[model samples]
Target: MVYQTDLDAVLDFPILIGDIGGTNARFAIVVDSYAEPREFPVLFTADFPTIDDAIQSVLDQTSLLPRSTVLAVAGPVDGDEIDLTNSDWVVRPKQMMKTFGFGDVIVLNDFEAQALAVVALGEAHLEKIGGGSAETVGSRVVLGPGTGLGVAGLVHAQHTWIPLPGEGGHIDLGPRTERDYEIFPHLERIEGRISAEQVLCGRGLVNLYRAIAAADGKEAPFSDPAEITSAGLERSNPLATETLDLFVTYLGRVAGDLGLIFMSQGGVFLTGGIVQKIVPALRNGVFRAAFEDKAPHRTLMAEIPVYVITHPMAAVCGLGAYARTPGRFGVETAGRRWRAR
Candidate 1:
């Protein structure tokens, strides 16, 4: 059901915007351009049977009729197909467009959209974690650890921001402490690979909990991450507290390494569910300690600003930005060359 492609002005087109994580899918109808959208509707995917159904429920939030949509999903989007890494939802882009009655559909990797959004954000939105201020427009890195660890980077060139995706989270994790060394073997016993995702994601915290508990010769406590976090912060469980400490330390190490590799002089933005779960811990743990631990170069790296995106719909804003310019990927260079005229 294709509409008139010649809608030149896009005046009445209410673009449906969304940020689809594995657990929730937030839907909104942008009455105007994405730069300054007004009305919004958010939803949880678990409450619906399919993505289509979720969108339908979102539409019911108001009388606004949507003509197009840009969905940001937390998973690999190759060709026209996408399968959420943490959920059972699978979608075909073309099919979704047809079903939703939209002439065109924009589907992007949620992290990629996040990288794009870094270009559009203003000062008031981002919360500074550590480090001083950001460079004007140098190389930057964005990382999120939710259901899994998502890695993406953006470089400025040709007056545009280009996002680069990487499977770096799956890279082998290395420990830098005596406690880490003890925990590493236990982690390896459980996951075998001990990938960054194993220690950096929501589940990764639980993994750290198990490993640390075992290292302390204690049995694995709870089955849920919330339980572990609760025990650590509220209940004051010794094992959970120690595990959270080590997890933050290792995360700092990984973030520090990533910063060096990317040479992110602009800044590094830390986001995702786990970080939100332990915001206070970030101030106390390895997040900055490990980040500034890079010897000799440590002082230089410390100059690089770091922030945590507190906005819940950050990725949605990113997806909305992606809908405006297509094919912004595939031409990024280490020297910061973007695919612009």
Candidate 2:
């Protein structure tokens, strides 16, 4: 499938860049091509009845008018109306252009923004995991486990970066080890099938804990992922500890799979709140061991680098990069871009 599109579009100066997710919406204003984005405080989606209200709040606070906007939303960017995968807020680029009097409005998937950040972010913003040096010219993968699991690929062709976003998180995942077999049967299923998100997201941690507990015939006392993580990190609960180990192992496996699929010699980056929190767990040998267990391709996988994105505003930074120089990235804006009449 053709994943890249060539469209002649330029966002005017004083652009508004937003990274809208299920729980939080972050906004920033770029005064000019050379100016850095001035970010506003994050807003909870629950507090705002609609996306319009949220944008208005940011405008009121900033008191800076923007002629164009670039939004990174949590769901697919298809057609005029876009609905968030995990929230009630619906984003309509055409409506936004009309409401805000914008000359241009460009929308992209949240993970696509993450993939762009992989290119825009410097080494200081990334914490290295187990792997060799990243090749200068190869595809890259960025996946995050947060409110949900997001996956995207970044490719370099024609001297421009291309971000490929898809529902890779929903891909089927199965057990490969004896321990996995024992826990797989107990985990909850979506439509009677297990996907990567089933055990890789925030709620996925809780699911893993519960499944592990069920396998051991023990009562699970924790329902919140944070609680389980805290207990696991502190070594206060065995079940939580086991859950965390398995979670990291599975994450490594999935990252390795994507790395092989894209030949991501540039790197495989891990993003989101969960990854940042579990840096200690990821550094343990189990994660890397699982990642390199692909048998025949173990040597090749070992040579690819892995990193955790440490930037607090990765998506915002990505949008800022695109707004500053749209030609630097090959973004498909056929149905995702709106213009003033």
Candidate 3:
């Protein structure tokens, strides 16, 4: 959808947009509203051992100095208590402002940035996975599974875009078939009360592997989700392939269900570390079928376009998108504690 933001105002020097994830913090240098953002530099949080150190490393790489910055983080963003969902680098926003000497340092949920990006991204930016011809305006759901399942919705409110944050990834998850019931029991040890996140996200790959293994009357054997995916790509491990396929199928099912719930006529965009790793696997075949396999109401859901966000730096674009939206985020970095609506 077209976002006619007078973003022409975000001058190059003061604006900085960063997407902070569990593993690496992606940073981009912005010159102005219309000028293209520079190549993203990924800084491993582990390399610096602290977010501030990582921030400094990025600044050291870039020549332009930014006065205002928006940090998109992968965790629940509440006031100044921004604890990263997967990592230990907790950001104290007020402290950050004092330390960085920024006039405005706005932090928001990472998925929220992904949602806001929908307004700025066009057809060339998106990779179609399922659904039909898209329109310029409509309600959309932008979510994905990675270190953890993240959810966000883009509601086109008249002339502006309203990015809605949701704890949807934590919503109760249930079994659709008898096989699933058996699978849930095996996961009981780790996930007493299963949420969609349990079978999605990075750790989710392991859950899927275990569930499938348990269903096969065997123990799921993988140290981590990454291992399982690597085995699946190698095609030498039968169990890994089956596990990954089931993960994709279930991912489609859950995303499809979300589309129906939100009536996300605008589109259902799947973006995250999981999809990026399995892009080739998802591009053709069963994944799209499962995404479009909604029963009874299939016709209505089928038309909802689904895209796999190919751009790794789309989140940064999302930050740019949000900055363009007026009254979207109010900033007050008076002190390590931040207060916002």
Candidate 4:
């Protein structure tokens, strides 16, 4: 059952919306334009050999047969095969269409779906940190620190929102303080240099903890990020506590830089499991102070609102929105969209 349509055509319902990350794959089905997205239980990538197997498991449990799908992946969406950055599974949209008997498939970067969620989400779904009210009109940015760092920008134009996704997490990070200079040399480098992702992600938290321990000439014990986070938040270990402080500080600096670059007056959103877990630390003056530390544009930075996305299915909701009303968003589908011809 092949469906033919132009580049700007609205996707036919029912639609499968997915947010595929390194650790988990979340799926939802929207039966129609007016119907809410019915979410399925989260699936671990390791539990399934391929994405097809995961989807098949979900299909076995439900009666819904979606005609189209929009998948937000953790890696770059280019060519026919899309590989997840931190996972072993590879997504092939063309192959999916044949296997699932779908008409269309749209691929998006994970952060791009996050950017779309920023526009679709309401106040109830956001937790404010510090800063003035968001501007009624302007660009917005969303950053997530999870298995890896993800970044995207959203801009309103021609009465529609356009999401811009890029590899902003790989940007270089340099030390600015005496404390930073002491610990940075001990940080693990990707290719001889430490990027923002080196100290901002899940493994990055462990890296920060080890670096702090190494700088103090102590043996690091914890290997898991959760252990470090628990010790830091509880103040059970001095090294873990200091590591969390530096982690938030560096996150603030990076967020401030992105805020200035995009002039995100709409707001700057912080997503992923890591941000939500450290909300208490994020509001404890250190994060906000570092965000406002931009000398030349301190005033401008202060006016930009920052929020943490509280909704668990934000990316799936974003894809559902696009599936329901494709004309409302200016998503470029030239190469990313595949059809069963």
Candidate 4 local accuracy as lDDT? 0.90
Q: For candidate 1, write residues 24-140 as lDDT tens digits.
A: 777666665444554355666788878888877777777877777766777766655678878878766667656767765656667876787676576666777788678887888
Summarize candidate 2's per-residue lDDT along 1-341 as a digit string, tens digits: 34333347567889999999888899999998788789999999999999999999999987689999999999888788899998999998778877989998888999999999998889999999989999886899999998889999999998889899898999888999999999999999999999999999998899989999999899999999999888888888899999999999999999999999999999999998889998999998888898888889999989989999999899899989988888888888878878885
The candidate with the higher TM-score, 3 or 4, is 4
Model 3, position 136: C-alpha lDDT score: 69
* Ten contiguous residues with the weakest lDDT in model 4: 1-10
Worst 10 residues of 3 by lDDT: 332-341
Candidate 1, pairs of clashing residues: none
Give the higher-lDDT candidate: 2 or 3. Answer: 2
Q: Please, what are the lDDT tens digits per residue for candidate 3 over residues 1-341?
A: 22223442232344677888887788876666555556456877777677888888777877777777778888877766678888889887677677777766667788888887777777787888767876666888988898788898877664666777767888777777676776777663344688888888887778778777877787666868888988887776898987777787778888888888888888899897778888767865667777777888878877888888878788888777555443343222223223221
Report the C-alpha lDDT of model 4 over 1-341, residue by residue, as the tens digit: 12224345678788989999999999999999887789999999999999999999988878888899889999998899989999999999889999999998989899999998887788899999999999876899999999999999998987888899999999999999999999999999987999999999999999999999999999899999988888888889998899889999999999999999999998899998899889999999999999989998899999999999989989988887877777778888778888875
Return the TM-score for candidate 3, rounded to 2 decimals. 0.87
lDDT of 1 at 336: 15
Cα error of candidate 3 at position 9, Å: 10
Error of 2 at 181 (Å): 1.0
List runs of model 1 lying over 4 Å from the truth.
1-12, 38-41, 188-191, 324-341
